[model samples]
Target: MNVHETEVRARALGLLRSGSKNADVARELSVPVGTIGYWKHLDRAKRGECPGRHDPKCPRCDGRGLDEPAYSYLLGLYLGDGHISHYSAHRVPNLMVTCGESWPGLLDECELAMRTVFPDNSVCQVRRTGCRNVKVYSKHLECLFPQHGPGKKHERAIVLEPWQQAIVDAHPWEFIRGLIHSDGCRITNWTTRLVAGERKRYEYPRYFFSNKSDDIRKLFTDALDSVGVEWTTLARGSDPFNISVARKASVALMDTHVGPKH
Candidate 1:
């Protein structure tokens, strides 16, 4: 194994010896919490304490032939997105092990865990069309990206796929040459609904195109309305909302205002 993985394993073993819970070890190490159970099983096997069939008394749940349900429960949460609330971590495991049923039960267990973890947080499900099928993902927006948050300047966002990237690149005059003066721009998944029941959604990154004119806001708003898409204006001072349509609309608006090159 690599140095990092070795160190993580050693640290996990140490945490177990120190009476630390698996969840604590996982969070502290930033590794999937389920790994602690795996190491413990390995240790039990090395000691020859594991059984040949249906062992039921292993203290670490390794040789007991029990399902090590804790590992599966924790794995699901980690795979779903390790953004659980700090408070919920302590109680979620117990509930999962005790709860019967299968996949749906697991989902219900997670939903309960999420509610307990983020009492005030709001959750929303977004559906999108993919090449293979329509897929749905759950997302939670904590709030507008903080103006002065640390790390990378931009918030955690979904990366665009190749086709989406192509559409974005085709409008390079607006995205690359116009909106951002930096080396490149990023697309975010933040959406705002101008009116209820609108079929199309609008994405707004934290930045926008050029900051040239005062009437740019109205111009863009009018353009979106002209195309039958409603929009909400965010007061971001000189920064334009980092959205594809906004970039496209802004380019069109600027062209109209400045007129075609003679």
Candidate 2:
């Protein structure tokens, strides 16, 4: 059915079947290499060969090393404001983290962490109303993020594997930074104080992280504790959903490392 003469087609097929590379066969037959590849692909398909089955670089499946600090930060972001979509086993899943448009720097950092974690895959940004969904496509996303599951993260039990915990234990500040960048904020509060016979205004800065999940809050606070940053729980009505870091020393530590999101 191809345009070439029947004899030429038979010769090409014969050369291909004899283990000749497409480029060599094309040079010998005076044909485009792509045509030779196409013929080979068709031949394979007719013989029941599956298409596009290959291994990508994956830490868990391929026994490759991971960037632990980046993984720790990405894990915090995933726990705070990210999700993985799995359509089927034959297709790769997408990992997405929502970042506010106001903080372009945070978006860049999020994308960088994703790229560092999955160096062989592609990372992209999808714009939404007032936010951007920074995403990466990888076949091994679930292997990296075991916290992925059904329903909302808060509804399900969110626990880290031992290896993940060890990484968090080593890079606690990066983990806290990722969480703060996602669901926390650094703000200033001011009040009038009597200092010299006249009322003077004084300002103090603090960091606050709010999440509906008790386990997530505990994880954040635990990381803070590991790094010697003091934190307290603030209750809104009956639900204690806020973690506040207002102590002078703790605020200084946070300011030095995870300052206000830009």
Candidate 3:
């Protein structure tokens, strides 16, 4: 049972000994009026009798597990184009992900992801110099996403926990969709072919995903592999590498799984 210390009990007794009202003592101590009232009822202030929540520091978040589909996709985006930060004085961590402004619909998807994880937490948006960002504040985010590291992801190692890995295994398509939507796009490639002794123009569709983090790129490729999709790295052995899935079969598979940022 949650009980109070002798200090609080003595203070409440001393204050009640004076002419101070229950509300006055509550205000002075930054506790609930009912808490002080209960203290007086018991002739002393105690914990279980108080009206405050069990976990005062974080009453809203259990800081426990994660949502399946939402977290898988959100993790993909975090690996692709997200960052986490926290302020001083026992502040909760904030997960901030940015995307190009042209795709306003992505904001809704991101908001859904945040709400999926932190149903009671707040999600906000802001427009930067050239991009848009969706931010969520919660104390449990770091617990779910332990990859929360400093500096660019490319400059550090990005790995997944077992539970997160299981989510990706079950929801590989959603993870790939999120990665492609954030750091990649669908494009129609054009080429010229001879038709009946005449030069004819033909078009084919392909998907491209690019990122600076090698580990993140590997994670994307691994998700694709899980779905039996083929990808090739372009301009290999270079900074800011690119991955393209252009084979007719691979393109068809990707088209079925991932689409334009809507």
Best by lDDT: 2
Which residue pairs clash in candidate 1? Answer: 55-64, 179-209, 205-242, 207-240, 207-242, 208-240
Error of 2 at 147 (Å): 0.7
* Local accuracy of candidate 2 as per-residue lDDT tens digits, 1-262: 6556667877988998899987799899997554565566556546654232344677877888899999988998999999998646324578889999899889879989997998866566766789888877777888899999999999989999898899999999899999999899999988998988999999999999999999999999999999999999999999999999999999999999899888
lDDT of 1 at 161: 36
The whole-model lDDT of each prediction reads 0.35, 0.85, 0.75
Q: How many angstroms is residue 248 displaced in model 3 relative to the true structure, after the best TM-score fit?
A: 1.7
For residue 38, give model 2's deviation from the true position in Å. 28
Error of 1 at 100 (Å): 18
Q: Candidate 3: misplaced stretches above 4 Å?
A: 1-65, 87-90, 236-240
After best superposition, candidate 1 residue 38: deviation in angstroms? Answer: 1.4
Better of 1 and 3 by TM-score: 3
Model 2 worst lDDT run, 10 consecutive residues: 45-54
Between 2 and 3, whose TM-score is larger? Answer: 2
Candidate 3 vs. true structure, TM-score? 0.73
